[model samples]
Target: MKTQPATTQIGWLGIVLLLFLAACAAPPNSPTPSPVVPTQAPSPTPSPLPSPTPVARSLRLWVGEDAAALPAIQAVITNFTQASGTPITVIPKPPDALRLSVAGLSLSGEAPPDLIWADQEILAGLLADGYLQPVRASGDALPGLQTAATSQSQLWGIPITAQNQLLLLYNRSRISSPPTSSDDLITSSRAAQGGLVMVWDEPYWLVPWLYGFGGSLTAGADGPPSLNTPAMLAALNLFGELAVAAPAEVKTYRGGQRWFGEGEVGLMVDGEWALSEYRSLTETLDLGIAPLPRIPATNQAALPLISGSFLMFARDLSRDDLKPAEELAHYLEQPTTQIELALALGRLPASMEALADPRLQADPGRAAAANQARQAPGLPPTKAARCALFGIDVWLPSLLKGNLDQAETAEAMQAEAEACVTQ
Candidate 1:
């Protein structure tokens, strides 16, 4: 152990010398190596909150049972339902009876309807009763139509369909073209076996004649009814002349309808509402439509009262029902829907855009009616005024039947109208 070989001794001494040299060569300022640490897995991402689902909604709409307009309205409602998730229930009621029906429903504590599709005359009464709510609109409408739907300076209803006027319907087989003047109509009728026949006694039909002579039921909107005037006398004289010259029918509306259908008259004064019926009769009769004939004295076309139908929201809608009601109402007023409805019903459009449609432009009859409506005067919103105007029937039959003289007839007519408006 004490005596070792020279190589072994030298190797041991070399290892000791190398270890001392390495220790002396190391830098004093060098950083020590830290212990290795593992990274924790990333925290799982938190889940997001769920979004709310939309609730389904539905509404009931009341419409007059006008065969001419009901189908068009239904088609529009169908399209609206497809576009929106809401469903609509259309209830048909008699136009004249709608006011009564609404009063009954509302009084019975039943939800009357989200909307009432009544004409302006009916809307006037409903508005008076506080049964309608104002609509929010961002566009303009026909001035006369806007007037008809407005009450107390507020827009109470949205006019969906207009162009309801007393139009002159003729049998195209007898008349090649519509007569431009009442004189021409008289001459043409004299040539035919049966001449022009109209629902003359009804004030709804007679107002056009009154207008032609520059007479009106009321002086202006919210004004007292002015039934007796020089204009009224002139109009009555013309009425008498027509009754004597033309073949007058006794029962106004039904008689004119029946006679026209039976080919008893060459020309019939009717409304746009009768277009469908007359069109159907084309299988046997060639029917044509034109604006009322011109009056020579006044130099004015017989201006039928221009009015419109209202898409009114019921005043008693519940909070939840209002959303769908407003949506449907707004949808009904869209240009596309208005255009479609106007085209289908052959009614004039309230939308300026819809009025520009080429289809409407191409229809001469509709264009003529539209032109007349553009110039026609609007009636007052007073129900009494309407009643007074219609009273022309009561005394008219007696006058035509020779039971009263012209002076007495005028007196009686004036008295009846005055009494009505005063009431």
Candidate 2:
């Protein structure tokens, strides 16, 4: 009866709304709802890019093709590269091209090297030609070496190592001990298998004999050649005597090297450049090295030319470029580097500090070289003197062959020297 008393009519919209509200409510017996998770914003990922490579600073170096020098120079360059993160391109140039390369007088149409290796002989020419720039080396450079690098009261380059005077290399198996005088040398050579061998005709070799006789190429550094002087005549006479005693195969420098290397010569006259080659040959042959014998007549030791290699800079280098180049040159001249070079090359060190090293003092060959340097004088490397050397090359054969008289040979040499100076 109560159920039949309902009076209000529900609308269709109200009925649908009541059903939606019932669906939204959770049932009392249902398990607890999971905690509502907050919507999270996603983090974006970045794409990768490549890193750029850095370009290394670089310099060009032209070094002589000397077998002994290359390794030492390359070692120094490698060290410098690693320390400074700079790259250096090393060009092995012919020794003959050293002067031309440094002077920017290239004949092969190649670009001039930024840094060049030159000997003191060519350094003089380079300085006179104005091809070399002044060095900014610390003033603690070796006095003698610094002098070699100087011209017109300015230092032009850094000295590396020095080639001592012409050395007397003999086969110890053939000669028990070194000869003290020219007479002793002649006696020992006469009994030996190959006998004395040298490039006696060349002025470079002739200088030692001339020096032994108290003769010089010139009276002054820039003076005319004194080829016709009495000292010259005496030197010529002594050289002639030695030539008569020596084997005919001792004609050319290369020939002498071959003869000595082959163990065919008993006494050989050579420079520091030949030390390594000689050492190689001595593995099979007994070799000995000593200073050149004294001239019996004059009672003077043979004083050959002492020269050094230099690091020369190009005149066209910009201030920025020049600073690094100079630093490299100075680095090479450092005591540690110089000592290493001297030990490797068997050469006299140009650095005084290197000279005082214990390693150098213990070396017998270097000891002889040091003694020879004390008696030796530097050879003038002027173009005129070089020209005179050419003339001597021409006339020397005739003089040695007995085709020209000694007096005539001297006169011809003097005339050629004068012509070269005047030109």
Candidate 3:
């Protein structure tokens, strides 16, 4: 209510200014205004990133002594690795020693070979023991194989090579005309000045006659324990005649190549692999290859013992591990590889495509060997059957020893075989 002076108003304004300054200098513990955060477009739900691609792996392989075919094998592995982005390693093992080593490994269950190139007889034993895995022919890995080779009914091993013992190798210079029949062969053998050089003591060498005479060492669809037939007796008689006619060294002849290579024998029944060694001896020596002659009475094609097969074996491998093994096996069975092996090793290729290879068609020796293999029949599946007449390992040496008479030996052999079949 009292009238104040201008100076008094000015003082009041100054006091208000001081109070504003004090409020602006408030304590540090006081709450402050927070910054405004912009909302992110809900991170586009990361499309579940696709999983990384699986990397391809490498494969390991075991091989047998086909030294001549090594280049082809290496090329195949290299090409396959390049194409599939995979890798392969091959270990070479001798054929003869392979079976023993594999057996020992399986027995110990330690570091068994991933694959084996084994004799067919040895494969048979291994298959019986469940040491191998059967494979089908139709697959991306080995598209070149014919279904016949991988037929499901008789799956045991993949036949990489087909070797038979019924090939009749003649010195083309000595024998102007090759015989077409067994009787002619017999007559020709007797007429030869140096005498014929068939593998007299080798059981496999005798297989053609066993079949030609309509004798089956193993039982057919009929049943078991029936090998002592009249046909077998006739085969035995013919064998005995040939044995008597052969040279004294025939008893001592360790191998067909030894006798044939020496040129002491005019005609020899042996495997095709012998051609190389024989050729080395005398390139000028005319070499002729022919199938075993048909028997006089029976015109049926004779059965020859098959040699060996390639089998896959991996200890405790999963399906993934088996994939490469199967693929490599298939690659080996391809027409190119098979044909090359046949040409190089003088062995028959398993696949029909290989049989029809142009390279083989161009070679007379290869063609003859292939033809002989196609015409020859396979041996009976049983061990007893093979041991009795096919000249399996045990009976072969005993038969060659010549200690027992034909009758006695046949009886003993038959008894052992029959016992085996019964068991």
Candidate with the greatest TM-score versus the true structure: 1
Writing each residue's lDDT as its tens digit, candidate 1 over 1-423 gives: 588999999999999999999988867777889999999999999989888876675688889747766887888898888888788888888899888888897477866788888888788888877888887654456676776776556787787877768888888777788888978877776675447677666677777878888887776666656666777677777776666545544455677687777677777778876777878876556887888899998898888888887788888777887787778778877777787888887788876666777888788667767777666776656665575575676787776677886667767877887777666
Better structure of 1 and 2 per lDDT: 1
Mind sharing the TM-score for model 1?
Answer: 0.77
Model 3 scores a TM of: 0.76
Misplaced by over 4 Å in model 2 are 1-59, 66-71, 81-113, 121-125, 136-150, 191-194, 249-265, 282-284, 296-299, 320-326, 361-364
1-423 per-residue lDDT for model 3 (tens digits) = 999999999999999999999899867796678999999777656688899988765555666655666676567668877766667776676766666667787577756666665555556566556666776554222111122122224455566766544577787777777777877777877775435776666667665777678776666522354446677666666777666547665554455456666666667776766666667777545677776676767876554644534555544556877777677667776777676667666666776666777777676666765665654555433455545653332454464457655565566667766676656
Candidate 1: C-alpha RMSD to true structure equals: 10.9
lDDT of each: 0.76, 0.74, 0.62
- Model 2 is weakest, by summed lDDT over 10 consecutive residues, at 1-10
Instruction: Show model 3 residue runs off by greater than 4 Å.
Output: 1-39, 42-52, 66-69, 103-110, 139-154, 192-194, 220-226, 254-263, 379-382, 389-409, 420-423
- Clash list (residue pairs), candidate 2: none
| Model 1 residue 146 lDDT score | 73
Each candidate's root-mean-square deviation in Å? 10.9, 10.6, 6.8
Off by over 4 Å in 1: 1-48, 54-56, 67-71, 81-97, 106-109, 192-194, 248-264, 280-284, 318-327, 361-365, 402-411
Better of 1 and 3 by TM-score: 1
Clashes of each: 0, 0, 1
Question: Where is model 1 poorest over a 10-residue stretch in terms of lDDT?
Answer: 243-252
